[model samples]
Target: MSELGIHYRRGPATVTGSPRPRQGPHAGDRLPDTPAGLQRRVAGPGYHLLFGGPTRSWPQDPPLGGRGDLVSVHHLGTQSPWPGITHALVRPDGYVGYLARGTDLTGLRAYLDRWLPAR
Candidate 1:
């Protein structure tokens, strides 16, 4: 899988001398096809932001502001496949673009800026 670039991770060459398994989903990993009807929810032309647990505390406006049109938000509640993950940004190709451990908007914003920079 590493050679194919599927669920592959490159760790320090000196540490363990090999790739180490990371917790939760990593970038480039395929989104889990579970919780039923998930494909339908994410069916679209742009990226999808899935949030775990209640999203009442999250800002009502899309995080990207004007660039929100490039990303659609969805609340997964407790149906998230990766436990403890607060959010997952799934790319249009069905692979994870980024993963957040908690309510880390700073990291997410950086990812969006890098990949989907605003005009």
Candidate 2:
């Protein structure tokens, strides 16, 4: 990536329960049985990233724009080195990006209509 560089390239990501459980009776199961525990669990980074395969969710947050809309689904990762694979770039200021074939980028189109220069 031009900004974060290859280090941030973790690959297509997914979300999952946290690694550590607070212990107690309800540990080892879904994040937390109690509302408070759930809060704490989500308070921290809790997503598993996956690279190439079928469509999946981002482990962390999806690439975000300055105004708060998901910008792109593809990002640089170990599995996506050398500008390889399908990719897209979103701008915080609302810039149009290239969308690879097979991806449903309806959200991007909506954003462009509302934010991009002409829109």
Best by TM-score: 1
TM-score for each of the candidates:
0.75, 0.21
Compute the lDDT of residue 92 as modeled in candidate 1. Answer: 87
Q: Write the per-residue lDDT of candidate 1 for residues 1-119, one digit (tens) a residue.
A: 34225642341111111122245456566676667777678889898988875677466775684677889988887777666437777788777767666665776777777778887
- On the 0 to 100 scale, the lDDT of residue 77 in model 1 is 74
> In model 1, what lDDT does residue 83 have?
62
Candidate 2: misplaced stretches above 4 Å?
1-88, 92-102, 117-119
For every candidate, C-alpha RMSD to the true structure in Å: 6.2, 16.7
Query: In order, what lDDT does every prediction score?
Result: 0.66, 0.28
Residue 115: error of model 2 in Å?
0.7
